[model samples]
Target: MTRPIAYPSGSWPPRMPADLAAAYCGEASVDVFLRQVKAGSYPQPVVKQGRRQIWAKADLDRAIQPTPDHDIAADVALDL
Candidate 1:
């Protein structure tokens, strides 16, 4: 099992691209993250510098939070 990445306090380069983000989050592959972003369900990028899409470490931390039970139930109901 891969350990999650830890950001240093007041570190330089607080943003990360998809591949590093995937590894940081312990995701199996970068494609998993890319698909979610393409699907429009993932957190929006903070900025796009050249060809690199960037997200804040804080934003990615927030994105991994589990949705509330009520919200999950509502989504499940809608799918039915």
Candidate 2:
């Protein structure tokens, strides 16, 4: 059996799957998250602890931000 660590360090960031799921479109679906991970759509994992992926919360949050130009272009295409 193995004991759990609280990840009391800045380097650790947030590695919980729930946090990752939330950062990924506010959905808690691990299946979709894993697919995105494989598709290289999510932020790169900062660290690999055993079999766990340590995702930087800031970086993960950044992935969801849409560029202004992309949104404007979409609006233009839609004539909105």
Candidate 3:
């Protein structure tokens, strides 16, 4: 089985699939979480930044737990 990604502490880079299997994806496998990611229902797999791929913290938050003020229509605009 694949190891679960640990939740980061404070301003940590929003990389890796967190413990969202049960929290967000409703399944108990990171595979399911990953599927959501693949389907764009969860955090994106990667973001291009010249020669680097950065996971935008904002995108991660909006994916798992969308803010009330966040416009649903504009939800698809990934900072990718």
Candidate 4:
């Protein structure tokens, strides 16, 4: 298993774990998150410090929220 990324509070550079990508994107796969980022379907994470990729928890929360055009009924059907 891959190790989780850790970020210190008030740290200049922030890093997020692959699991966070799964939680944010509703898909437990880092590859999927990377694909979404490449496709512009998801918000890009900020790169702070030297090479750390940081995603704000608030930003991730907003990104995961259902949009106005989301088809709730369709999602429910798909879940079944």
Candidate 5:
């Protein structure tokens, strides 16, 4: 006997691509999202099942969070 894998309701692929787009770009554009992934700037899928790539919702959410802007001036004080 084999144990069944567990997943949240409505959690699956095809949906993941779109979800990633919406989470990152605020729209359903997987093409843009995939491009970023290919460029190594975005988070890749958490897992690969067979031929399908799967991403965790939490991970995707984290990737879309806004990064804090760095201020170079703040790091250095000019003495004139």
Candidate 6:
């Protein structure tokens, strides 16, 4: 018999998908998020367990912070 894996509280599971629409503005998709990382527009996520990529909540918060010259609408569109 195989034992099930367990996760600690507040940690995203390895290979788990983010709730992007709920967590991001303008209904961003996971692919868009990955694209943003590839484009150097956002912080790169760490690979968990040498197999999965997980985004830190802090990094996402930093990416969403308002800036004077930033266009929120454009960012949303690009990520959607």
TM-score of each: 0.58, 0.53, 0.42, 0.59, 0.49, 0.52
Local error of candidate 5 at residue 38 (angstroms): 1.1
Query: TM-score: which candidate is best?
Result: 4
Please state every model's RMSD to the true fold in angstroms: 7.5, 8.8, 9.3, 5.8, 13.5, 8.5
Candidate 4 lowest-lDDT run of ten: 5-14
The Cα error of candidate 5 at residue 44, in Å, is 1.0
> Whose lDDT is higher: candidate 3's or candidate 4's?
4
What is the per-residue lDDT of model 4 for residues 3-56, given as tens digits with 9 covering 90 to 100?
A: 443334553323365456545556546666766777876667765556555666
Q: List clashing residue pairs in candidate 4.
A: none
lDDT for position 22 in model 4 = 49
- Per-candidate Cα lDDT values, in order, are 0.67, 0.56, 0.54, 0.60, 0.54, 0.53
Residues 3-80, candidate 6, lDDT per residue (tens digit)? Answer: 233333674433333443213422245566556677877667654456456666566667668899988788668756
Better of 5 and 6 by TM-score: 6
Worst 10 residues of 3 by lDDT: 16-25
Provide the lowest-lDDT 10-residue window in model 5. Answer: 1-10
> In what order do the candidates fall by lDDT, top score first?
1, 4, 2, 5, 3, 6
Clashing pairs in 3: none
lDDT of 3 by residue, 1-80 (tens): 86454444553554533453223334446656666667877655465556444455566666667578977567455422
Which lDDT tens digits does candidate 5 get at residues 1-80?
32223333654434354444444444335565666778865667877677677666666667656558855455345321
Please count the clashing residue pairs in each candidate, in the order shown: 0, 0, 0, 0, 0, 0
* TM-score, candidate number 4: 0.59
Ranking by TM-score: 4, 1, 2, 6, 5, 3
Which residue runs of candidate 6 sit more than 4 Å off their true CA positions?
1-22, 25-27, 73-80
- TM-score of decoy 3: 0.42
